[model samples]
Target chain A: MMKVLTANRLTDGIAVWLGANGRWLERIDHALIARHREAVDALEQAGQSAFHDNLIVDVAVIDVDEVDGEIYPIRLRERIRAKGPTFRTDLGKQAEFQQASAA
Target chain B: MYRYDEFDHDFVGQRVAQYRDQVERRLSGEITEDAFKPLRLMNGVYLQLHAYMLRVAIPYGTLNSTQMRRLARIARDYDKGYGHFTTRQNIQFNWPKLSDTPAILEELAEVEMHAIQTSGNCIRNVSADHFSGAAADEVADPRPYAEILRQWSSNHPEYSFLPRKFKIAVTGAERDRAAIQVHDIGLHLKRNEAGELGFAVYVGGGQGRTPMIARKIRDFLPEADLLSYTTAIMRVYNLNGRRDNKYKARIKILVHETGEAEFARQVEAEWDKLKASELKLPDADLRAIAAYFAPPELQDRAEGWAGLAARKKDDEGFASWVRQNVTPHKHPDYGVVTISLKPIGGVPGDATDVQMEAIADLAERYSHDEIRVSHEQNLVLPHVALADLEKVYHALLEQDLATANAGLITDIIACPGLDYCALANARSIPVAQEISNRFASAQRQQEIGALKIKISGCINACGHHHVGHIGLLGVEKKGAELYQITLGGSGDENTSIGQIVGRGFEPEKVTDAVETIVDTYLGLRESAEETFIDAYRRVGPEPFKEALYGKTSRAA
Candidate 1:
């Protein structure tokens, strides 16, 4: 229900699914996306490319809805994305996991 | 005069380094514009409409000859051979490049200065009475306490990330030269019944869109608890202050919403936890800070009244300058000289390189190498000997810095409105110029008597228009510039927000409106002693309203 789509002509582009009813919003070169290399890369891989001397990015996404045009799974996914990951995912946590694996 | 200790030095060095890293990252494409926005803002670098502006703090409006010289150097090397001294006792380099800020910070740090906490949502460079040490009416020097607050709030982890930018002002004198009531936190230094130092703390005063005079939170807070108590207030504001709307994010709004009594109770609860902390400043530390600001050695000399009288009798120009620019100093043989940056029709606060050097020379030679940037956007030599007044006045006249309109109607405070500010809705400088030209007569100004006319291009109130006796606010209506007039605002000990007189006026009609208001005041005034504000208060705005709108109009 939730789709992360990237534009072919933009870099650091993100297409967020807002609600159902095929309402897809794209934010390009946003501060948060610009800060996260992985997020930017994911968008780039999904077809977003550098534009306007690499300063701007263009991206798009698609969303399907139920009979009433109400977004359900897409809404949930967008909410999750907006809030970010709940658990710790930094290098310190990774190192702890690595130590446990070695033990 | 608070010298940067090892800790202070290290912190500034680290701050510069951190900002350098952020700059490097932004330049190298490691971080995008979005990520670097906050980072740049935190370093006092703003991408203004035309160019990047670097606001360097002049803490408590106090500066030594060396610091001022360094500022001159910065103006010469980095910026266009001039700088704009702001209402907040800070200087802004109007044309700094984004890439050159780190080097600028490095240079500033060399002079025991940094742009830290200047632009960020933090305890900004705490402003104080310009005549802190030299004012005739001052009970005690306020700079020592200001310096203490500066240190306490510098990189103070918890309060640094508040909902909005915060400003604090201190004054030891009875006359509120610092405009304390319009600041986020206003500290009035007072001696208690037991002869111990204490603060009459006021909270939630600010001047942006909603200009409110700070309400007194604590009638008497012990001097030792200044830091801990302030920390508690800031913590409470940071936690409970609204972040949803940027306009309502100021502590004033929070205080308004929660009610002062409840807010004070909450602050008290927070202070209970912080009272037992290491934030309580030691007597030795206070003494050490106070030692740096100890009064300069005074020479026993005659009051030079005869020399001043002789000059006044001989030269009309010298007499005019003395009448307007000279203020009473605490020392019998000394007087405070305000070297006007507002030269006739020039920008209100802009000083060229030559002017800066000239003032610096005057400060070192005549005054005691102490220069103060007043909240009214003028420079002051706090301790000019009475004998040297004529010489200093002549020198100032030569440099075109001597306007001799310190508190007159010509001494207008206007923000860099639509011309430079990206947020301005209308032009402030031109309107200020129009008003200044209208009141160009010395006789009329003397009659007006110490009136403040502040103008802001927008509701942001960067010009402190809310506290002006005549407040001009520029608003956009139907895509045209319209000016609103407010009367009877006072920024002194008895602070009050000005009330809007009537409907907005066209840009061209604003001067006429101001004249009408002044005319009304003059006609209604009981005597020469009763100022525009006094007459307005006594007679009410009805006369002024009648003068502006006429009797036939029914619209209030």
Candidate 2:
């Protein structure tokens, strides 16, 4: 299973996925996929360092599965967090993601 | 409405200044999240799934037009143009930023409102019967007593940090509209044989992972001893409540561990000492506070009866709204108008800023400037004159607020579950919306009269699912949403924790299951008057189980 490190930004508290470029990206699709032990460990380290630096809070490495070239969270909670509420399509990061795709 | 005095103004101003400094420090990286979390929580700032959610105290569900307008302003200016009213009669902005919270608090304070003691492990905002002063059946207005509790509990040095968060509710009516039995301390204000006001105090009742009905500790405590008696109960709970397990930390567990009888004894022993002390409320002060809640002088608007009759005879929509939303008031000329936030398939308890502003205008025009937030997630204009109800209904219609569903199947009480809450296991709003949409027909809803379908995403029971006529608790099973249905739960004078029907249903099947339950009730009910709760009580869960799961199946 691939893992992605995620946390909410300190100032705005928006959920962000740790991107491959070592930047916290708001879009989960741009998240860094750590499939190996060393990469997962590095992701954890980045999360820990980010926490101490007060860049993010509630850091977690959640399990994800890629199918048909699409990444999706294993847990419903993290999925909701990554996207937005299942009911309200126009409100979360998903909305922005949709907007970016449409554009 | 009780106006904030100078002391209140200074107190709120100082707290805002203090919180502003704390927010600044945290923003500056001087304060860490670990240390700042508690401080932020004390001001009702919660970090939810999407963003920081702020729960502002409504102070016993009572609000004047100015306050309501101010809340609308916050909704428009700070939040996402909407606010969700919770079961505690508090309004929660689902999309508040951490940095904006201080300013929000400042704005709230401008209207004599604050988020203090709203979230911490302290006495939370004291809620009262939404229809307290206007209800025809009420013994007296309960907001005064609730305000007294609010004053006593807010930032009390001794009880600030307890084993867990404590909730207290007051109901002046015998009907138990405040859900007092499900609170940490439930005070039922009543009159004794001598016609003197007092309270029937129930201690250690709460709903969460472990739902328990409160036990009556004192049959009658004099109104004067409200503070003294409550102080003693707090003292006992503070000393004895379990702090070892976060799950078992509520005073309900303490009252359960120490037998209710023994708990009563300890509280009585503690009260004996504080009864004659300075905690005893003076008559003059009590009267003074009560005077602030004095009912507006209403001359006999006897012409309203005929006017309302003619209007109702003409307009079917107006008649249905008045029949469903408006309840009898203390005065014959007026009625308590409940504005159903639950529109068909709409989110329960949510009002957009525009809708809120419109409601405020209606309150200012018709309800003597008073509005109320009901724990059942509806807004109430408690003093709407009968003559002006047509106007109120017409105005509410303009804002999509005139839903003629009060105590009906569509009037659901749902918490912000996985949709927004960080602690939720599944989404509650969609489920509520689905169930509401399924039972959306006004005729069908009236047929299934007085049915409350309360939904919570998790076992935290923020939606009061444990007390619903048909309760749906959403749980995550194998990474999917599974909703368990509970039967026969009620939060009225005769409160009962609902019984789980059987194995849970999937998200798609949950509404069908509710329909099955409602159908079963309709099939077996003796008469239309026998409510869903009453029918479920009489029939037991056997038939409903047979209907939901096959008769061959067993309970989960």
Candidate 3:
């Protein structure tokens, strides 16, 4: 299993995942992946460091799987966090880019 | 309806200013999340799954037109154009920014509302009967006492950091509309043999991972002793409540461990010391507070009796709505109207800003300027003349707020589970939507009659599943959503924790399981008048279990 570091940004509490570019991204597809044990440890350390830096809150290292070069969180909770609330798809990060930005 | 005095205004303003400063510091990285979490929580700000959620308290579930309008404006401006009405009768904005919360609090304070003490290990909002002054079954209005408790408990230094959060609910009717039996402290206002008003006090009832009914500690506590007795219970619990593990911290756990009778004795011994102190309320003060809740002078709209019947005959929709969503008022010409937020295949308690503004307008014009948020996740016009109901129904239909199921099967109570909540193991809103859609037919629902299906994403039971007639508790089993069903629970006067029936059902199969339970209940029922609860109570869970699972339904 692979892992990815995730947290909600401190200002607006929007869910974000640590990306390979060393910046938090809203879409989980671009998140930094850790396929080995040592890489997973590095991701956990990065989550703690980001949390301590006050850039994010509720930091976690969640399990993920890559299929056909697409990343998907193993748990439904994380999946919802990555996309949007299953009940109101029109309101969360999964909404249209312009509409979500407007919100 | 209580106006903010100079002191109230000043207190709320200062708190808002304090929160503004705290938010600024956190944004600038001068304060850490660990240090700033409790401060924000005290102001009702929470960091949820996708965004920061702001829970605004509606004291005793009462709000005037102006205050409600302000909430609508807040929903439009700060949130994503909608808000969730919680089972505790509070409204939550699911997408508030941490930085904008101070301004939201400022707007709320301008209307004599605030998010103060909505969270934290303190006395949360004091809830009262939604039909306190209007219900036909009358004893006395309970909101004044609830207001008094609100005043006494706000920012109290001694009780601010209790072992766990505390809740107090007050209801005046003997029918128990407030679900007082399921609160940390349940106060039932009643009349003694001499016709003097007092309360029947029940303590330690709560629902969570552990569900327990409160014990009747005192049958009739005099009206003036409200503060004294409450303080005594608080002091006893504060001193002895378990601080070892957070899960076992509620006073219900204490009452269970030390027998309910002994817990009452401890509270009594503590009360003996504080009964004569300043805690004893004065008659003048009580009267002064009660004056604020004086009912509006209702005019004689007696012609509504004939006009309403004719109107109902003209429109079957209005007649069915009248049968389900209207409750008789104390005044013969008036009726309490429930503006159902449960539109078929729609979210349970999420009202759009436009809908909220429309309700505010309706309350201002026709409902004595009063609005109530019920624990069942519906907006209520506490007093509407029967003659105006036809007009009100038409207006509600425009806003998609005219669902005729108030207590029926489609009228489900659901929490913001994994959808927005951080603690939920499964999704509650979708489950509620599925179940509601399955039972969407109004005719079928009316036939089922007064069935409460409460859903919770986790064992915390914020959705009050432990007390629902048909309770569904969602858990994560092997990383998938599983719902366990419970039978025969209720939150009314004779409150009982529902007993868990057979094994769990997967998400795809949960709705079918619920339909099976409802079908089983309908078959065993003696008559149409026998409610699902009555039929279940008459013949225990064996029949329901056998229907759910053949012979293998021994126990979970």
Candidate 4:
């Protein structure tokens, strides 16, 4: 299973959820809601909602799950997204495994 | 001390402009790494493992106080706070960014220095004896001719993209301080029967995996045809040298395959066509270059041994420094002092920013504002008065540059090995440090006498291990660092290729092996005057082999 979390930009913060076997499946949304201007004004006049103005320009979604934490590929991707790629750590285990299989 | 002429200055300026454009293109994403690789390399910018490295040529190891100060400024501003002087008489900045290289080159051009031909398959920086003009045993100074070659080869349109990088060295001295025999073309200056200066030229000498002594191509090449003849030889190699295998691309392989006589004949045939052409150097051009290297004015001073003895008696440290660092000069009242870069456990050839400034200051104060970087990875004050030796020694000591181990055992030549170099197989400095620590005692080193131990991390032989009296080659064996030892090599007048004694030794066993070889020499030597090379030549490697492997013979 795999899931994606979105933020403002690539350099902005990111969070992901992983399922068992070190994978993600469920997506969670935490975004601003947009409403018609008249409806918002009416709500403000009637005092039905606390929000009176402002329309949503952006939204973000996150995925969360438990993971087995043993699969290297899933762990590596999570690690890279969390931090950054290792500059001098040679190649990943997946590449080494592929090479071994090819050999 | 060859200053740039109008033509040289213009050529360097054009090169700097070209490099600036290339750097701009690289930064603007117009050129990819693959496309810009050769372009940047042509300008002596290398994308090394961690960062970009720029190799600046110090032609024939000669520099004035102004140039030294400029190098110090470059180190302080552009690079990391230090510069590593390489074994090829070049200085490498290990931490220069890609974008700052052009500005660095522009600054270098201000001081009449550039990094052209320091890399790539062009004629690299021409090297010569460090004590070129001042040595008493010299036939003539080789720098003027070196300068002539430098002019002829700098970005020569036809031969720029040769089979591989080419190197040339010239020496006029009796002792081969320039390691001429290991260069692509080694020119030994000699005078003919008519007292005309000429060159005894050797071709195809190099020190990689297939280490070979250069063979004599011409006994006496007249000074007039120097450039034209050199061009002919290079052209012949450019056309005939190997291109298929990078390992076999050097002219040494070409000489090996074609036979020396045939190669010499081919060069002669090529020269016959081009000898009287525009490529030949004019006498006026030669004289112009020679004028720049004219000796500085000397003052007649007391020549007696009084000054030296007085210094020796007054300061023991100064006495030790003089005993090791001071070398006889052509002038009676002066001497050459080698500031050893190989201080006990320090990185060889590394001078910190402060150290560079201090050396520059010392040169200006005491050395007639002249300094030289020897190919052996040490700084030289070419003209130090005998009376001021103590003063200079104390000043050097303040900077931790005063190590009295000029030609001693601990004064080892080591490349920036695995710690820094991307090409290295194993670390060279630790091994060198181990050796230094094992033989740190001054008394022991003095007893050992003049011994040169050169170590190279890989087969490229940048550290010139093949020419050392004791050569150590670092190799990786089963994921462990191993060292191979060779005995009996000499880079001097009677050049000889060292012979490998036996199989490789583990790192832990190498120091003991070296000690055993030294002990074997001490036991077999005829007298204390017989150096390590002489003893090795006299007795051969059998005794040393016996001492190391202990009667167990390994199949070759």
Q: Residue-wise lDDT of candidate 1 within A1-103, one digit each (tens)?
A: 2234423211112223222222333321111221245644554443333322333332344332332432222332222222221121221112223321100
Compared with the true structure, what per-residue lDDT tens digits does model 3 show for residues A1-103?
A: 6999999999999999999998998878788999999999999998889888999999999998876677878888998888788877777777844323211
Candidate 1 C-alpha lDDT tens digits along B1-556 = 6788899889999999999998887666788666777888788887543357789999998887778888888889877688889999999987676778899999989888888888878889999999888989988888999999888788778877789999999999888998888889999998888988888999999998888889899999988898999989988999999999999999999999999999999999999999889988888988899998998876855758778889899998889998889888888888989888776666788888778888889988977788999988999999988889988988888889878899888899989776556577777888888888888888888888878999998999988898899999998787578999999898999888999988999998999999999988888888899988888788887888899999865564
Q: Which tens-of-lDDT digit does each residue in A1-103 have in candidate 4?
A: 3333222111111222222232221211211111345533432332211111111101122222334322222222233223221321232222223321100
DockQ of each: 0.02, 0.82, 0.83, 0.03
Q: Candidate 3 at B520: error in angstroms?
A: 0.8
lDDT (10s digit) by residue, model 4, range B170-255 = 99976889889888999998799999888999999999989989999999998889988998999899999999999999999999
Model 4 ranges with Cα > 4 A deviation: A1-103, B303-305, B554-556
Query: CAPRI verdict on model 1?
Result: incorrect
User: Could you tell which candidate, 2 or 4, scores higher by lDDT?
Assistant: 2
Q: Candidate order by lDDT, highest to lowest?
A: 3, 2, 1, 4
RMSD versus native structure for model 1: 13.0
Model 3 misplaced regions, further than 4 Å:
A97-103
> In candidate 2, what are the lDDT values of residues B1-556, reduced to their tens digit?
7889898999999999999999999989999999999999999999999888999999999998888888899999987789999999999998888889999999999999999998878999999999988999999998898888888887899889899999999999999999999999999999999999999999878888899999999999999999999999999989988889999999999999999999999999999999999999999999999988999887788889999999999999999999999999999999999999999999989999989999999998888899999999999999988989999999999999999999999999999999899999989999999988998888999998999999999999999999999999999998899999998889989999998888899998999999999999999999999989888888899999988878687634
Q: Model 2 off-target regions past 4 Å?
A: A99-103, B554-556
Provide fnat values for all models in the order shown: 0.00, 0.83, 0.94, 0.00
What's the true lDDT of residue B256 in model 2?
96
User: Interface root mean square deviation of every model, in Å?
Assistant: 18.8, 0.9, 0.8, 14.6
lDDT of 4 at B427: 67
